[model samples]
Target: MKIAGFDIGGANTDLAIIDFDQGGDIENIKTDFRYLPMWMKNEELGGYLLDLIGEEIDQLDAVGVSMTAELVDAYETKKDGVLDIVKKVEDTFDIPVAYVGLSGMMNASQAISDPLQVAAANWIATSQIASIMSQNCILVDVGSTTTDIIPIKNGLECARGRSDFERLGTGELAYTGTLRTNVAAIVDKVPFDEGWFRVSSELFAISADVHHVLGNITTEEYSCDTPDSAGKEKEDSLRRISRVLCGDLDLLSTSDIESIGDYIYAQQSLKISEAISEVAEREFLDEVITTGLGRNILAARAVEMAGLDFTGMDEFLTPEECVVAPAVGTAIMMEDYLSDE
Candidate 1:
């Protein structure tokens, strides 16, 4: 059987495809996964998403979807986008569609008691690995709009608080990210031509562009909100950086751009480290497992600041396995139901 796991985020959509000959564990299957930035073009996101499936969309036997689309600003209308996408899958391929709910140890009725509690809670990949990686740890998942510092006590995901909104204020939420952070949200001051200038509070360059200039983040992941990013020139980078800082390239030098990017990286690093420490203080976790895009950078900074050992989600699984872990983990938890023949 062929199975696909879809993880929809605010900035990107990740899809993992796996194939199993007989009805066996998903972990034992071969898998392929890719992260695509489809959030920038919200209007064409659905079409762009379909394009990602390539030839696999037509041949998959079963598919499951886990989404964080509700975090989008236009969520009021696209709240059902996930369901709509699922409907497209059903319509195109005539395959089974599984909407992963936030319940591996409980019933759907109990899990739905708090709907927004849903977020990416349906993902079983990190949870499954966490159970084995570290028993007492905090899992820090940093995506676009938020960073979830979920406490894992005795190999289970403990509730951080009452509601998601509360979690947003706490370190459980760090609205800054590597690819899509607003520069104004990070620092108010910018040094240009040996003078400090205030930055604009508008939506300009993303944290990705800043990191790209500083060489902290890779060009591969420099997927900011730049138009036609695939063809962005050095001039474009300079312009984007200038807008982010509320300065022009003529007013600044090449060194200024690099400095601004470094500053952004530093600010982001501090925020992540602070949040990780908060979860550790509250839960008294001895270990922390970091995942998502900013895992390595955040973990490195966290280790230096907190004097704690940090582990990556990839450390416990193979490259292919790690890519599909969340989706495969979700499917693994649903084994009893899917295999109840």
Candidate 2:
């Protein structure tokens, strides 16, 4: 059997294709993470999705979907966004599609009736899989736009909240991320040249700039467009980070700009560490399972800083699989659901 799963978000769309043998053993897995920027080009989403999984779409036995794109500004209301995305998926594919909701998998009609259950539920899918892997562990997924710190105990998801709002209150969700988060959101002040200085709130730089300057991610790994709309070159990244302090290359030395990146990175790491401490204290989970695009550079450092034992998802999954764990989890869940029936 072959199953395809999709996790659609505001900035990126992740897809996973899994093939199982006759006895339901895993045969092959292929995954793709695409930067769609759904808010800017809502009309082109269907075509882009189709292009991502070209020939394999015809071979799939079923499709499972989880989404967070409803929060994008392209729609007036979340309901409108949910219904529109459902329509696009239905119009593009000709298979038994199941939307992964908060409760369980549902058909498109059922999903439309309960839009709230489907909105921003991709984290649940990833956490469910993590629970199956480790009974008492915290799953920390730091993606391009947000971080999810979920607790699993006794082989079940023990999250304190189901919705993003409740999760935020419970310290289960942090809006800080690796790629697109604004630097201003992470820190209002940074230390440079043995003194602290306030950051400019001009949206002139983002977290990607900081990461690029610190060598946390490669130039190719910097997926989003740069703040200046120039390029992802190291020099460009350094200039952008300098702008955070309202200083350019001419005004600041390279070491000064690097110091700014280090400070911001430490601040972001502390944010995730604090959230991990909050969640870990409740369940006493000692092991942290970190996954997502930023796991190596951000999540691992955060876990270490929090003084907890950590395991990268790469220890269990391929590098490509780690980036789209939620999509793979949705597919695995759908495969299990079908196997039981």
Q: Pick the candidate with the highest TM-score.
A: 2
Q: Could you give candidate 2's per-residue lDDT for residues 150-265 as a string of tens digits?
A: 99889777788898889999989999999999999999998776788998898888898889889988898898877788989989988888888888899998888887788899
Can you tell me which runs of candidate 1 are displaced by over 4 Å?
A: 20-50, 57-59, 77-93, 105-125, 191-196, 227-235, 318-325, 334-337
TM-score per prediction, in order, is 0.80, 0.97
Candidate 2 wrongly placed segments (more than 4 Å): none
Each candidate's lDDT (Cα)?
0.61, 0.88
TM-score of 2: 0.97
1-341: candidate 1 lDDT, tens digit per residue: 66666666655666666665565644444444334443444555555546766777777666655665545665453434444444443454455555555454223333344444345553344565676788888776655445667777888877555335666665666667666777778888766667877888886776766666766555555544563243345556667778766667887688778877776677778887888788788888768777666666555675457667778777865644543456555545444345653
